[model samples]
Target: MEHSMYPSMTKELAKQRSDATPEIQAAFKAFSAKVFADGALPKKTKQLIAVAVAHVTQCPYCIRGHTELAMREGATEQEIMEAVWVAAEMRAGGAYAHSSLALDTVNQVKSRSGA
Candidate 1:
């Protein structure tokens, strides 16, 4: 089997300037502003949360934005790295927790089906 470092984006089409209508831009800007609100949380906390959420969501744009924000908010390199690790741990835990439910379901199915 062929292995790739990242999920393929080949099927994902890039947008041209003409492809972006004014309404689309406005909507995107509004959504982003709402998600990354102004001063709703402490800058440092917000940056860390943003970084963690970015990692969890697997959003490269969010990760880059928040990594910069974290640095600007006086977070040390070590702190930023630790925050990413924390995100990784939480995401892995969530996956495992959910998988346990699936495992239980499989077990129940096996018992009922006499597999």
Candidate 2:
């Protein structure tokens, strides 16, 4: 059955991209490995961060991949939930931070209109 919207298309596209540019693919793979490796932060912590970032980015593929990776790396459900909450807070904070731009624009418009 040829499904138009195959769920595995993410993997297939990644494979195709890697096949088309092995060097770039290798570099990315190496970089990702180094980033996720245990150093100051534990692997489980890194995976939890990734899961949180995936949630913030709203990437379904990344969310699934990192959630599974976090689980495999021994992140508990509570920890994952906390990470998600952190992401939520950060996402909202970003919008709140950008509200300064809106305030500035409003002030400029008021000044121009002598309001």
Candidate with maximal lDDT? 2
Clash pairs, model 2 backbone? none
- TM-score of each candidate structure, all chains considered together: 0.66, 0.87
Off by over 4 Å in 1: 1-19, 34-40
Native-structure RMSD, model 2: 2.3
What C-alpha lDDT do the candidate models reach, one value each?
0.80, 0.93
Write candidate 2's Cα lDDT for 1-115 as tens digits: 7765436657788889899999998999999999999999999999999999999989888888899999999999999999999999999999999999999999999999999
Cα lDDT tens digits for candidate 1, 75-106: 88888888999999998999888998999999
Where in model 2 is the C-alpha error above 4 Å? Answer: 1-6, 9-14
Error (Å) of candidate 1 at residue 25 is 2.3
Tell me model 1's lDDT, rounded to 2 decimals: 0.80
Write down the RMSD of all candidates, one decimal each: 5.7, 2.3
